[model samples]
Target chain A: MSRPSDVYLFGTCLVDLFMPDAGMDAITLLETLGIRVHFPQAQSCCGQPAYTSGHPREARDVARSQLDLFPGDWPIVVPSGSCGGMLKHHWPTLFAGEPEQERVVAIAARVVEFSDFLLNHLDWQPVDTGPATRVAVHTSCSARREMNVHTTSWALVDRLANVTRVVHDHESECCGFGGTFSIKHPDIAGAMVTDKARALEDSGAIEFVTADAGCLMNINGKLALDKATPLRGKHLASFLLERTGGKS
Target chain B: MNSQPVTLYPSRQFKDNARAALADTELRGSLRSAMDFLMAKRSSAFPDTDELDALRTLGEAIRQRCLSRLPELLEQLEERLTANGVTVHWAETPAQANAIIHGLVAARNGTLMVKGKSMVSEEIELNHHLEAHGIQALESDMGEYIVQMAGEKPTHIIMPAIHKTKAQIARLFHEKLPDTPYTEDVDALIRIGRNALREAYLQADVGLSGVNFAVAETGTLCLVENEGNGRMCTTVPDLHIAITGIEKVVEKLEDVVPLYSLLTRSAIGQPITTYFNMISGPRRPGEKDGPREVHLVLLDNGRSQAYADQQLRKTLQCIRCGACMNHCPVYSRIGGHAYGTTYPGPIGEIISPHLLGLENTRDLPTASSLCGACGEVCPVRIPIPEMLMRLREESQRPAGEAVDHPLRGQGAAASTTEALAWRAWRRVYASPGTYRLFGWSATRLRALTPPTQAGWTQNHVPMTPAPKTLHELVREREARRKES
Candidate 1:
């Protein structure tokens, strides 16, 4: 069974509403590799917010609307590891023993995060250009455990010429965004992100990148709030595109 | 430890305790360093991932098999224990267990009881009960002795005094111990505690210990510990009473091998604990130095409540390794004191609800970030994050409504405003047209969105919606492509 040449992009709710540039960069990257990308018109949210917030019934209703968006078995690529993990790992279990269980299983198989799709499925590689810079990589919990996209992101970043991959303390620890968790338990979330910010600063990296939109938004928000913070956060899609001389 | 059931519902104060703990910089530093060290040790212990993963699978399977046939196994355990001349007693609640133990002690006219570190005893509050009835039970474990002397509870299960520093322990010893000078050395502090406990062991009329594993086939109660105090407490005294939750029983002695290996490795990162004491029965004719009478008290508490439900039955599979707590981000930050339960951290969050009901422990399940670190490090492979989600759902249900879950009417339901808002959100996202309208409005009204979003704005910049939705940008791109 050969990999699919074309795929559909699940523009996550966070991407659609919060950062459309990332979603567009993902599409541009796929098309640059000569693979046709389909953006379904009806897709909205992956229901992760409701699902994780303890409203499983609502989560199912919202998730059910997306169960048939890409019906022809073309792979469904998600740019954010948080959303990709939800679709690939959690959706099947959420609908277990239900009417849509079979469809959920089939959909789960085709779902892959952007970096994972690029490196493993499409064999995408970036050409090195000599511009020395130290950059730190922040792998979201979902990216690290659920999809194993951290290794792919690391490989992608390491391949870029003259870019030193600096290691920091506790890189794999959560930034504590956790979607609603930041809002619900802001103190703990704030403390967690503060520690993450310090680690990034201590690494002396000019910029940090993450594949998940949730952590990017969280760490970036924290960095933006602190005027003295010397670090910047970017989505892995935008970072990869900039490094490879592709349009953002 | 109180003799009667301590209020398990004190988890309601979790928020307040967590706030106080967060403010304590010293506690935060200790917890951070301790958790980091323990996590690194555990990872280093299992250098071979394949072997560790396979062992975890076997450990999980053993627990599942035991729980699936729990009733049959319990009967088998009783029969085997009786045949071995070990008296097995059953208690359904904390009060009953306390009464049964107290009766056993009173019958023997026992004045002093020496205890090994037992979380179950803490759960039943046996020491306080014994104290009230004129029987003194002294904690023989160094950490447990310090906690007991300081008039505090065991904060961490394995490392009860983990929250204390060497200097603080030295101070505690000088203040509490008889004729003890202040010495800020680790070995000196251990010597102080050892000297105090050695006399108690000899003078203790009865010995109390907790079981790490109860083998049904062989009727052997296995105790895992680094110190030999557990052995002293169980063997040196004339009478010995070992108590454990009903869920600790396994089908055969062989099943304990993988579990013991994982427990030791995951617990303190040792290939094996210093002592693995397995006591099948009291002394027979020629046995030189064993207890004359051995008593086994099987306490249920709320274990059957957890066992009756299929999804929650996984809570019973825990081997009390403490790896989950060590790796838990929330626990590391807040420490165990904030949890205010007999068992604290990830395992406590899932199991406390069953013992104390959901209404009291509602905050505990919601306390985690759902980071899944606990699940990854768990030796028995307990799906902690999944259970937290399930408990969250249980918390949002209305009281007395018809639900099939075992924890249905047991929750402190969410406020009406929260429930209504969630329902409205479901309505909006269920339809594509409605979602598009909401998204468009959100983008247009981005400027009006509050700069201060529920305390998040205090540390983070305000959340600003993008100027245009992806759908709108895609449509514009399509129009340009068509023109080209």
Candidate 2:
């Protein structure tokens, strides 16, 4: 409700490794926006692999560790929709009957995805990014269903006068990363990502941006495999940082 | 529809329907085109609205309550229906149902019965039996009309004539109605169908309809549709026979409220349909146009099996929104004709075998790609893929191309390749130690491997064993944590 005593910046595993810039950008952006960002060094994977894999017990074990590490009224600022979605939508399901569920539920109330934070809480006169360019937005299913991130992401993107943001037509479909689903069931995953990438190429846009790194990686990997060009997948935080001219 | 000999269970004939469907390039193309079009139309109608999930949750709760006390509700419905001066009958099996229906028609010495689009009637093959007994049954629905004219069964539940291309339908209509020029335009086709069926709706001695849901408290049967033909079928005729299963009952009127929310959304993706007519005990007190004698036949058939199984019983809760059908990848590829049953798609695959018999209908369960999209899109959150898996276990069919079963039970034939594959899986999954060893070996083999598996891996990908097994990764990480 009030200012976060400490903002636990959840740089999701994908962003932490693959697109470290988005991780750093999220932390810096949050601090600049006047929230104290705390990166808990103890944090590991959010156990989405276990949860979606139908291993609920293992997922709960991972959820409990995160629950213990990140406590109090601190807003858990998560950049990736996949991880944020897990925490927002699925963590409750994992810790459903546990007595400690109350604590997890309370923490969930304060957990805000990155796009949600900028759009909902901040009234930003978005720092003078030299100019925004024609952008295509791909909202992850998790972001759309779990976080309600579209209107928020759009409003934030729209405020930048130079950004000509266009939403993808088949944007609602999954990119098919689905955690380990890509590696485990590669054919279906490949077909799904191929479909997503083709939709991106057909959109007639120069750049594509999404809120989830898992989606970005899956799409980018498939894009590379297919050798389809002139469109690239980028994190929303990365796109935002570039538009704002922090560092490209 | 590839023509195949019909036989009983896992026979040379029955499993051929799915094989024929999968092999038919033309029909598969038609299925894909229709599904993509319908799904797009639905998505456009319900474009990321707030009303979606709320509606489904309410529907799930209502349908579940209806199925739990279905027997009691049916009795209440019967009493209420009888009190309203309409005749009510109960049919425990398809034969019993047909007999009861035949007895009623025989009492009237009926020659012709106008039929609305009733899946239950098809399930019971009532028309064939009636025809055998010297009664003509006319299909009133335009899609049903087209299929009947062509001597073909309907392929899709909602889009019955979907298997027939516009061109094919034009040919059927041309043969049936020589005066009308062959036209592929849907509007013209509908008009032609209306011109043909309009007379039959008014002339038939008895009308027949399938109940979508019957409210037990009020004895009200809801018949929903886009066309008003159902209304004519139920009301214009002197006697109306409403045939439905016992699972269709709900304890109270209020229960209908919640399911209606999900029903319309799932069926056509509208907040509601164009028409949702609820008829309670037919006609009363000089009711201008409704049937003079109404009969609600609660046909059991095989629904009691679903009610008996704890996990499967919730299947009765289905509102037949056809959302599962709409989103099913298998249905999208093969169409309903491939299932070779009145019901098709994920829900159909699970329920059909019980109605049709397990041995012959094993192919329906195996037809799935197991993508779980149907489960995700289901309005009631039926966990469709899970049920499909359960059906697979119950089935006597050979393992689908992707599944490798090492230990085949008695009387179940095991092929050499299948045995080898399962032996490999059994060796791997027997223990974590073996699993890790297999994963390690798989990584080494990855470099020498071709792009796809030798046989099964072409359509589906073989599982990629990670660089480190999950057990190893977890243990190594925990050890590192302890050291730190």
Candidate 3:
């Protein structure tokens, strides 16, 4: 497939509120590649929280609101794989039997995760301008299974010549920030994140990068609380922009 | 027959149970090592991804085809078994199944029944019922034997004693059995268990086992196990009884090829188990050393209810490989006992609601992080995560909502507050204006964000919004671009 001249950025809710810099960096990286990025102001949450929580009606209502925003044929690039999966894979199921089913399916077909859009569509190969640094990559379950872009995320990171991608133990396991699951079963979620944090820290990386904001927040929050280690996490978009010398 | 109720961890106390299980360092270490080993074994067993995918697709198609004609296949199975001189019994409930088995034993004046590993028997609390009626149901499978000897429920479907370390098993044997010395040596432990169970096989008036697959076309009941205990249990006694869920039936014996291959490989990474017993019927005329009577008890136990819905019928496709639990992150963390059901982990979360009702197993569905590992690793391609989400929907549906097929105890976990919160979330997110305003205010008042956020803040710091929303950042960039 040829690279599109224009694309729409679906900055997920977590990126919009908790990590605005990541969203901005995503636009910067896209723009640096000579592609015109369109940010639709009407976009909001992907309704994944309610969708996975079994509230389909509410999830549909919220998800339906964004269907009209991306009216163009340009690919919709989502920085977070979790939200990207909700749009690409689950929207059809959410709108099944409804009049908007075709519309949702068409929109879902154009949905592309950030790493996948960069690695596959554009074939991005960035020149490393930053200092030598080692970083670990954390792939969300949605990215790994739902969107099937975990390898693309890793390959995108591996493109940086100066960055040494360290592999963590249980790299495929969940970081346990399962939206409401963290709030519902905190102890289990805590145990999962604790193990994930320890693994990342033990990987000898100064920082970890993930393509999903939920995991970034969960891992960083746990690391912030633990004064024992100074290891923190960064969103892949920002990390990529930083390594590629794009102004953040 | 009145029997002592089977000991249960009670799904209602899932939170407490998970907390308790997580606190046990020994159990955590054992589960961690076991899961790692099993995962590695399974991965290496199927080194070719393309071949694995093709096999899984075939396995799924076979199960779906069999389930599409479940009623007809079940009837055909009964007819073929009957023609082959085997008694086939249908049970709609656990109590009815127990009564049928108890009556059979009582008719034979059986004082002891040597049993192979059977989770269905555990589901019906058959041992307790038999013991209540002056019958001893001795578990002959090594794992099941260890669990029964300790008077504890099997923690895992495939490996009942997986939770117990060898040292723990040695201590259990030394304390529970007569004149048994404590020995942590694995070989010695197996010898001791085998010796103790050897006499029970001969003394048992009846033998019982579980069927992995019931072939309707061939009238053969297939049993897969690593140990020879299942074969011994079926052949040693004068009478043998096999119990299984109604969903275990396959239309043709050939259909079992892909399923059996996938089951062992996905389960413990074994290409084939040590013993694969195919019992068609009782000893034929002049046949040597086979049981005189063979009976199969097909128990519904809420399976028909699951079969009623097209989407839910997929839950019946499970081959009981226990691969889902082994691959599940939540199961690895909390272990199987924390689930408090006959089947646990991803499969249990979906199936338990049907068996025990959503009200009794409300928390089971929501126990996972929606990690998708179980669904990915499933041999027969059971969409376990999707089924879990569906169960969660059933558990929280409105009290009086109408549907084509309502699950038992629907809306058991529904909460007015949770519903209202989602409603509020929809209202804010569904509108561009409200969402923008909410984001703006949230960021502006980020300092007022509370330090403690119920469960989230229990371990980590509070989540504070950024000073500027993406909407604002994008707007500023657009303005600057136009000005430049």
lDDT for each residue of candidate 2 in B390-461, tens digit (9 for 90 to 100):
564444234453332211221133245544544454444333355446555755565544566442243233
Please provide, for model 1 over B152-258, each residue's C-alpha lDDT reduced to its tens digit, 9 standing for 90 to 100: 78778899878877788889888767799999988988887887788888988999999999999999999998789999999999999999999999998899999
Best-fitting candidate, measured by lDDT?
Answer: 3
The DockQ-derived docking category for candidate 2 is incorrect
Give the best candidate by DockQ. 3
Candidate 1's C-alpha runs over 4 A off are: A1-3, B1-9
- Cα error, residue B69 of model 3, in Å, equals 0.4
Q: After superposition, how far is residue A178 of candidate 2 from its true place, in Å?
A: 4.5
> Which pairs of residues have clashing backbones in candidate 3?
none
**TM-score for chain A of every candidate model?**
0.96, 0.91, 0.98
Model 3 lDDT tens row, B44-154? 899999999999999999999999999999999999999999999989999999999999999999999999999999999899889989998888989888888777788
Q: In model 2, state the lDDT of residue B378.
A: 72
What interface RMSD does each of the candidate structures achieve? 1.2, 9.0, 0.7
lDDT of 3 by residue, A102-165 (tens): 9999999999999999999999989989899999999999999999988987898789999899
Q: Regarding DockQ, does 1 or 2 come out ahead?
A: 1
DockQ of 1: 0.71
Q: For residues A1-248, what per-residue lDDT tens digits would candidate 2 score against the true structure?
A: 34454578777645643465667667666666677766765455576754554344445665666676675566788887768878876677667789888887887777788888777766555865655467777777667756767567777777887878776655666666666445444444455666678878887767888878777777776676556485787888777777777664
lDDT of 2 at A241: 73
